[model samples]
Each structure stands twice: as C-alpha cells, then as structure tokens.
Target chain A: MDQFLQLIVAGLATGAIYALAAIGFTLVWQTSQTINFAQGEFVMLPAILVLTAAHLGLPMGVAFIVGSVAFVLLFGFGFKRFLVEPMQRHGVLPLAIATMALSVLIKEAAKNGFSAEAQPFPSLVPDGSVSVLGAAVSVRDIAIFVVAIAAILGLQAFITHTRTGRTMQATAQNPTVARILGVPVERMILLTFLINAALALIASYLISPVYLAKFSNGETIGLAAFIAAIVGGFNQIRGALAGGFLIGLIDNLAAAYVSSAYRTAVPLVVLVVVILVKPEGLLGRKEERTV
Target chain B: MLFKTMAAAIALTAAMTVSAVAGTVKLIDVIELSGPGAPAGTNWKNGSDLAVAEINAKGGILGQQIELIHYDSQTNPGATRAAVQRAVDEDAYVVLGPIFSGPISASMQITQRAGVPQIVGGEAAAFTRQGNNYIFRTSLNQADSMPKLANYLRDEVKAKSVAVVWINNDFGKGGRDSMIPELQKRGIQVAADIATESGQADFAADAIKVKNANADAVFVYLNEEESARFLRAARQQGIAKPIIGETTLLGAKVIELAGEAANGVKGHVGLLVDAPKPTLVEFGKKYAAKYGFTSDHNGIKGYTAVYTVKAITERIGKLDREAFAKALHGARIDVAQEPGILIDTKWTATGDVDRESFLIEIVNGKPVVKATLPMINP
Candidate 1:
C-alpha cells in the first residue's frame, strides 16, 4: 500500500512537469491554430541559457530572469515574427513543418553552443526526503507539484477573468471575428507564444535538477507533452492538464507493476487506446462541423 | 678526384639521413566526435593527442614521425564503417578507435577484411570473442570484469539477493547478461532484472520495484547521466540497499549529478583518478592542464592504447600492420614505463587486455579507491 501511494505521488510529481508542458502546447495550438513542434525545445532553451549564465558568475535569480527574458525575446518574438508568422500565410501544415525544423535547429544550436554533456542544474528547493504515509518523497518534488498546480490555477483564473486573456481566447475561437471586433488578433497570437514560452521556462527550471539539462532532453519531454495534449483534447487547457497527469500516472504505475522494459511503450499504448475508444478525449467536447 | 668522390658520398649519406627523419607513419583514429558520445570521444582524442605529442618528442616511433588522421563517426554505425573504409583506403599503419560497441562491431568486418589492426576502447566482451584476430581492446571486457564484481558482492558484501536495473543498449545489456550468471554462480537470487532506455529521466517505477523486491543489493548499468537519475530516484524511494554499479557510474559527472544520493555507492572502475600511481598522477595533471578537466577512464584507456601501439611497433621494428597485430597478440607492457592501469599489462590471443578490476566507493562526491581485486585471467 505504501509502495502504491509512493508510485502515485511520484507519478503526480512527474505528471506536473508534463502538465505544464502540455498546457504550453495546447495554448499555442489554440491561439494560432498551428502546432508548435518546437515546444519542447523552448523548455530546454531557458534551462541551457540559465545554466550558461550561472556558469558565467551571475546570481541564480538573475540568471533565471535573464534566461526567461532571452527565451521570450528569441523564441516568442523573434521566432513567431520571422519564421512562424511568415509560414502562417502558407497554411497550418507549412507552419507546423517550420516549427519541426525549428526544433531541430534549436537542438543543434544548443549542442554546439553548450555541449553534448549533461549539465547539472541546482535544485531549487533544499535537498532532503520527507516521509509521508510510509513513503519517502523529495522536498523538491513537493515544490515542483505545488508550483505547477499554482501556475495552472493562475492561468485558469487569467483565462476566465482578465480582459487580455479573454481577448486571446476570443482570437483562438474565431480570429476573423476577433480581428473585426478590434481584438488585435496578431498581437494576441504573439502574446500566446510569449505566455507559452514562459510556461515552458518554468517547467524547464523545475525539472532540470532531476533530469540534468541536456540538448536532447527537449525531445523526450516534448514527445510526452505532445501525447498528453492529444490525450486530453487539444482544444481545452484543463483537459490537457488532466491528460498530462494521466500520462505521468499511467507511465509510473505501469512501469512499477508491469515490465520496466515496456515503460516507454506504456504511454504510447494508452495514447492508441484513447484515440480509438474516445476520439474526443476524456475531457474534450465533440463538436459538429458544417461541410 | 678522390676528394670530390668523398664529398659526394658524404652528401648522399646526409640526404638519406634527412629523408629517414622526415618520413611519416600515419595512424587513423575513428571516434564519435559530435553527439551523445562526444564527451567521452573528446577525451579519447585528447588522450591520443597527448600520446602522439609525447611519442614525437622522444625521437618519433621507429624514427618516423607519427601523423594521426582523425575521423568523426558522429555516433553513427554507418559513419563508423565509412571511416574504417577510409582508413584502409588511406593505408593507415594502424587504426585506434570507434569507442562504443555498436560502431566498433559495425566496422569490425571492414577492418578485419582490410587486414588493419584496430585498437578499441569499447568494453563489450563480444568484440574480441568473434574470432577477429586484428581487433584489440584497451579496456576490460564486461565478461571478465563483471564476474569479479559479482564475487566481491557475494564474498565481501555478503549479498544474497540482488536487483538489476540496466539501460537497454549494448553496454547495459552486455553488463546485465555478464552479471546474472556470476550472481547465479554464487547462489544469489535474482530479485528483478529491469531494462530501461538509455536517457530515461524517470526511474520511479524501477526504483519502486527494486524497493519492493527488498534485495540485498542493486546492480546498475546505465551511462553516467541515467545512472545519476536512477540513483536519485532510488534514494527518494528509500531503497537503501547497497548499490553496486558498473564503471560508468563512478565518474565525476555521475557524482555531481547524483549529489548526496551517490554516497556509499560502490562500483568497478578502470581508472580511479585518486589512485596513487605516478603515471596516472602525471597523466591526470597533464590532462587537466590541456583539457581544463580531470581525465576519466576513457581518456586513460585512449592514452594507454597509443602506448600499446608504440610498444608493439617498437618491438616489431616496422610499420607493417600484420606484424604489429601478431606482436600485439602476445605483447606485454612493463608497468615501469606505462601506467599500472591495466593489471597484467598483456594481451590474450583474442586481443583483449588482461586487466585487474578496481573497486571504488563515492565519498563526499568523489570516488575513493577501496580495493584492487586479484587479476582475472582472460
């Protein structure tokens, strides 16, 4: 029973990371109607940048801020403006392909600029394990869970209550109508990219200590988040969050009970089952389209 | 007329001496220079570079300057094959790397068919076991080392049941296979044998399984980063059983990444940086000065590989690959000239080096040598 509880807690902590990354993916897809395949690379960029800054003798807080600002300016503004926006006119397929290319470009650039070696990230919370209900849990894991949940709740509130947030949602729903209503649809899409970038940065900072910041880490995290978004329904933010948690839980629990050899395959199996059984996902709504 | 004839003869002798001094013996190094294996590959290159510098400084190998040609395998098997073919095409006197098992295995047919002597740093026992006469290993094969490790766990640690978690690659799989038989031979129960992907970050499920199994010790065979991740996860899950790991887990990178969780973890190491050997000490200091980081086992193995080549070439008194391979078959290096990194300092007929395995435990985020095991015959 303790083992069961431990697995669940571990799953949730891991799920929190996936949830944050999934939310970022869902946000960009909803706002621009184009998938940002490089969403995972965005998460990696901040961690690498912050690690580089910290190595250059900057304070941790200052390095983190610089990393966040750099991510926003480069990926959010520079990437969206020059690459994504130009391809947007060509269609969603082209834009998505461009993002895929961008993912490779970012990965190679990071490898060349930094190193292929995994760089250790300092733990944000103090190092130590706390026993909870017969299970030992790291304090950092708890901090990650709390921060991820808080960020999700804050995002939910902003989407529901804030003017700019609602305007962003309006643009996502019907860009043509939103633009006609003076919502500045282009700016809203860019703002969505900025918000997603910030979310990715937060996830990277939280998880780097566990995984170690590496050039290729983005691909693993990104693939999981991508599957999470699909499983939760791409249209809804809360659904994506729930989907992320489900993946984390299923992945951990399956690996524990079943064979660890098939741990990586467990999530994919769940994805296939979800796609076949519930095409709309657990929390996604079924909407009819006029032909 | 006699004076002119003597002057011509002297001029001819001087010209011949100058030509002999200027002639070059080319060696090819095929290694992964850019990818997942780059860190270790870079160290391998540095080791060879240091050896080449030292050899040339001491009046060259057989009076001919050694010219090293390097090819980046890019961590691809296909690229490694091409590099080996290129080495054969260039007629390199000897070929030095392709450190990972996959690349080495992939390019073995090319090197063997081309009749070029290839010295490798890969630890896969199967590399030399395949009846390839020309291939030689500078590192201890898992087949030979893992038994010693199992014996240590059984006799010294008194472990009865052990759980094994390994990466699902050639190195990890080979290590797991090698360890299981030895553990079984000692009547130790195999609690659980789990294999995970190479760069997997989450080890919660694996750790939980090990904890539930309640094994006396855990044997791990993941590369440095994944090893750290597993250690962190295991410690978090409160699995406090003594963890016995593969040599890859004892590096500075693993220690840094695993932090306090790495404490008390014991493993087999090829080269312990803290070992009180003058050769290793001097090599470590020189490596730090050149690379700005302490040399690990890979760097040491790579350095030793060049010396092995130098030893063989010097013995045979030529740059012929066939003769070099034959000499390496029964060659032995004196510990006085070379570092005592390899135990017996000799190669078996199969081209695998006979080396003693060293045990190390992580104390305060650094590997401290515990004991040097009795030499295991190849």
Candidate 2:
C-alpha cells in the first residue's frame, strides 16, 4: 500500500511534466486548428539557452528567464513569418511540415551551438526525501508536482477570465464570426503560439534539472504531447491535461507491475483505446449531426 | 667528354627518384573527422596523426618513408563504407577506422568482401570476430569490459543489488545483455533493467522506477549526451546511489556537463588516467605541444592502432597480404605512445588484438588508478 501511494506521487510528478507540455499542444490546437509538431523543441530550447547563458557567466535565474523570453519571442516571430503566412497561403499540412523543419533545425542548431554532451541543470527544489506511509518521496517531486498544478490553474484562469483569453475562445469557437466581430483572429493565433512557447519554456526550466536536457529532449515532449492532445480531444484544454496525467500514470504502473520493456507501448495503447471509445474525449463535446 | 658527363648525371637523378618512390609504404587512415560523430573521430585522428608523426621522425618504417592518406566518415555508416571503398580504390594496403559500432559494422561488409586488412577502434567485440579474418579491433570488446564492471560492483563497491539503464541501440543493448549473466554469476541481483532510446534526454520516469526498486547502485550504458543528462537528472531527483558507467563516460565533456554530480561516480575506462608509462608520457607531452590540448583514449587508441600497423609492417619486412596477416597475428610491439599501461600481445588467428586492461577510478573529482587487472582472455 505504501508502495502504491509512492507510485502515485511519482506518477503525478512525471504526469505534471507531461501535463505542462500537453497544455501547450492544446493551446495551439485550440486556436490554430493545427498541431505544431515542433512544440517539444520549444521546451528544450530554453534549457539549452539557459545552460549556454549560465556558462557565459550570467546568473542561473536571470539566464533561465532570458532563455524563456527568447523562446517565447522566437515562437511569436517565427509563427508570424513562416508558420502563419505559409499556412494561410498554403494549408495546415504545409505549416505542419514547416514546423517539423523548424524542429529539425532547432535540434541541429543546439547540437552545433552547445556541445553534444549532456549537462546537469542546477536543482531548484530541496534535496531531502521523506517517507510517507512506508514509501520514500523526494522534495523535488513535490516541487515539480506543485509547479505543474499551479501552471495548469493559471492557464485555466487565463483562458476563461482574461480579455485575450475570451478573444482566443471566440476565435476558436468561430473564426469567421470572431473576425466579423473584430477579434483580430490572426493576432490571436500568434498570441496563442506565444503562449504555447512560453509554457513549454517554463516546463523546460522546471524539468531540465530533474529530467535532463539533451538536444532531442524537446522531441520527446513534443511527440508525447501530440499523442496526449489526440487522446484528450484536440478541441479541449482540460482533456489534454487529463490525458497527459492518465498516460503518465499508466506508463509508470505498467513499468512497475507489468514489464518495463512495454512501458513505451502502454501509453500508446491508451491513446489507441481512447481514440476508439470516446472520440469526443472525456471533456470534449460530441459533434452534432447538423446535416 | 662534357656532353657524356651531363647525360650520366641525368640518368643518376632519375634512378634515385625511382628508388625513393619505391621505398614509401602506402597506409590509409579511414577516420571519422567531423559531423555527428566528430567527438570520437577527432580524438582518433589525433592519435593516428601522432603515431604517423613519431614513426616518420624515427626514420620511417622498413627503410621506406610511410605515406598516409585519410578520408573522413562524418560518423555516418554509408559515408564510412564509401570512405573505405575510396581508400581501397586509392590502393591503400590497410584500412584503419570506423570508430563506433554502427559505422564499423556497416563498413565491415565492404572491407571483408574486398579482402582488405582493417584495425578498428569500435568495441562491439562480436563485430570484429564475426568470421572475418580481414577485420581486427584493438579496443576491448563490450563482453570483455562488462565483467570487469560486474567485478567492480560485486567486489570493490560491494553493491548487492544493481539497476541497469541503457539506450536501446546496439552498443547499449549489447553491454546490458552481456552484463546481466556476468552480474548473476557474481551473485549480484539486478533490481531493474530499463531501456530508453539514444536520443532520449529525460529519465525522471525511469529514475523513479530505479529509486522504487531500492537499488543500491545503478549501471548506466548510454552515449555521452544521454548519459550526461541521465546523470544530472538522477542527481537532481535525489537518486543518491553510486552510478557505475560504461566507457562513453570517460570524456571530459561528461564531467563538465554533470558538474559535481559526476564527481564520485565509478566507471570503466580503457586507458588508465594516471601518469602512463614514460614513453606514453613523452608522447603526450609532444602531442600537447602540437595540438595545444591534452590527449584522451580515443586519440591514444588511434595512435596505437596506426603504430601497431607500422610495427607489424616493420617485423614483416615486406608488403604481401598473407605476410602482413601472419605478422599482425604473431607480432608484438610495446607502443610508447599510448596513455595506459599496455604490453604487446599477438593478434589471435581470429584477428583480434589480445591485450590486457587496468581499472581506473575517479576519486575526489580526479581520475586515479585504483587497481590494475591483467589481461583475462576468454
């Protein structure tokens, strides 16, 4: 039983990272009606950027913030220039291909700019492990879990309460109507990209020390988050977050109880099952047969 | 009389040029110089070059000046195979490297089919002994290296339970698979064995499982990038057990990236880091002077391999393929240019360099000599 509770805590911490990454995926899908295959790379960029800046003698905290800001700005500008314009001119698939190219470019650039070697990020949380009901839990896990939950709450509030948030929802609900009502759909879409990149940057900073940051670290999150978005229903943010947590839990439990070799396959199986049972997803509304 | 004397002078000059051309030994170096695998190749090239430099300085080999032709593989297997074919086309007597397992395996088909001799650095032991007499590796095979690690865990660190984390590639999987039976033989129980991809950076999920398993120590087999990240994450997430690592962790890059986290970690290294033999020390000093940087195992392995070729060539006294193989198999030459303590051994008829290994320990943030294990041949 103690081991069971411990697994849940550990699962939640892992889920938190996936959740943060999944939210970014949901944000892009909600506004743009397309998935950014490069979203995971956005997460990895800040960690590498912070590591580079810190190596150049900047304070770690300042370097992290600067890195996060740089990724956010890059996402906004790049989306406006390459992603949005080409997507508007061509179609969604072309933009997806463009984002993939951007992903490959970021991976190679990081490998070239930074040494291909892995570096340890300084830990943010305290380093003691506490035993609760016979299971050992570290302070780092708690910090990751709390930060992930807080970020999710903040995102939920932003989407529901803020002016830009309402405009984003309006654009998502009906892009034509939102533009008719002067919602600045293109600008909202770009802002959504910014929001997604910033969130991913935040995830990178929080997780780099605990998770390790490699040039391809971003791709792991990006691919997994794509699966989570699909499993949760691309239309709903809550569903993405829930799907991420579900996948994380299933992965951990599968590794612990079943076979560790099948760990990767478990989350994939979950995605497939979710696709079959609830095409609309847990939080998503089923489409009406209007015709 | 004056015209006849001038004709004699011209004839003498032409004869001397022919003799000088006849005396040069044609050696080809197929080294990985740049691209994704440059880190490994760069060091190998330094070693190979240093060896060539020293040989030339000592008045060449077999009374003929040695000529070295080099082609870079860029760490890609296809590129490496093409590079080997290019070397063959250039009429190279022997081929030198395709450093990692992937490239080496890919290039072996090309080299083996062509009946060319190869001295490689990659440590997939099975790759060298795959019934190919033309292929040989100076590096310890993964099979030879893992038992040493298992011994270190069982007898030295005294960890009873160990967790094995590895990348799913041939290198990591081969190491992990070999380690299991060896560890079991030593009475050490494996708590968990997790496989992740080479390009993967995050191991928090895996780390948690390792922690939950109550493992006393962890064995990590991965590339430099993944290993470094795994080390950092393991440290940050508070998995405070000792990490026994594979040879890839020997780079200074691993230490720099892992920071204090890597300080006490124990790993297996091919070359001892302490003051090597006096001959190696002198060579190192001169190499540092040339490259403006210190030498590592990859470089030294490269150096030793080229000289091994030279030494074998010198003992053979001729350039026949059968004679060269016979000399390489039976010949022994102590290389003064290597970093660790290495004694010469005959290349087995199977075409593998039979060499001994010493154990290196990184203590208090310095790689120090812990214990020396003589050669244990299978």
- Give the TM-score comparing model 2 with the true structure, all chains together: 0.82
Q: In order, what fnat does every candidate score?
A: 0.58, 0.35
Model 1, range B13-108, lDDT digits (tens) per residue? 543233234488778999877756676687788888888898889877888778887899987788999999998777777889978887899998
Task: State the displacement of the C-alpha of residue A242, model 2, in Å, after optimal TM-score superposition.
Answer: 1.3
lDDT, model 1: 0.82
**Interface CA RMSD of each prediction in angstroms:** 2.3, 4.1
DockQ each candidate and list the results.
0.53, 0.26
Best by TM-score: 1
- Clash pairs, model 1 backbone: none
